[model samples]
Target: MMLKAMTVAGFSLFALVATISLDASAQQDDNLIPNDLAIEAYQGGWRSGGSDPTKECLAHFNSKYPTKRIQIISTSEESRKDWKGHVEYKYQCTAAIKLK
Candidate 1:
């Protein structure tokens, strides 16, 4: 009986820690959204192309959320397309922040 009680207590403690860890990680993870409306700023043939979506998104998140350390991982990015006087580009980025 004592052994069983100890085991249950251990399991409960582990479960509580796991829940806290998951909650912390969820809080750290964030979806990046660029403040600038024009993620792909290439307006016309004469205009220069926009910055890298992943980097831009990372910068935006880092700047917006001040933290000791942060890591940005680009989950996926859209294909780049270009044509005469026209361009279409898009991408997505995610950020994982660490508290130092």
Candidate 2:
């Protein structure tokens, strides 16, 4: 009877340890960046004659981080003429992650 009880206790301990290890690994995976999305802001500029500068900024961000989708949170535009008289556009964009 004593031998049987020891075997059962050993199995229970092993099961407990395995469960704890699996839980820890799952928690670590939850902390990984691939599972989470963080909002990031970027600035991009284009010559005046080009398409919308705000769109240009978003496009640039999408090109850089193709895996992540961008949602436009906000945008600000600045206009300044360069030496060549071409209007330079500066765009400030705040975006949230739409997908991971």
What Cα-based lDDT does every candidate model obtain?
Answer: 0.48, 0.69
Question: Which regions of candidate 1 fall more than 4 Å away from where they truly are?
Answer: 1-48, 79-85
lDDT of 2 by residue, 1-100 (tens): 1222224645742222222236677787676446457677887745565667568767877897788777777888788887888787778887777563
Residue 60, model 2: lDDT of 76
lDDT for each residue of candidate 1 in 16-49, tens digit (9 for 90 to 100): 2222225667655753643332222211122235
Q: In angstroms, how far off is 39's CA in candidate 2?
A: 1.2
Error of 1 at 23 (Å): 18
Top model by lDDT, which number? 2
Top TM-score prediction, candidate number: 2
Total clashes, candidate 2?
0
Each model's Cα RMSD: 13.3, 14.4
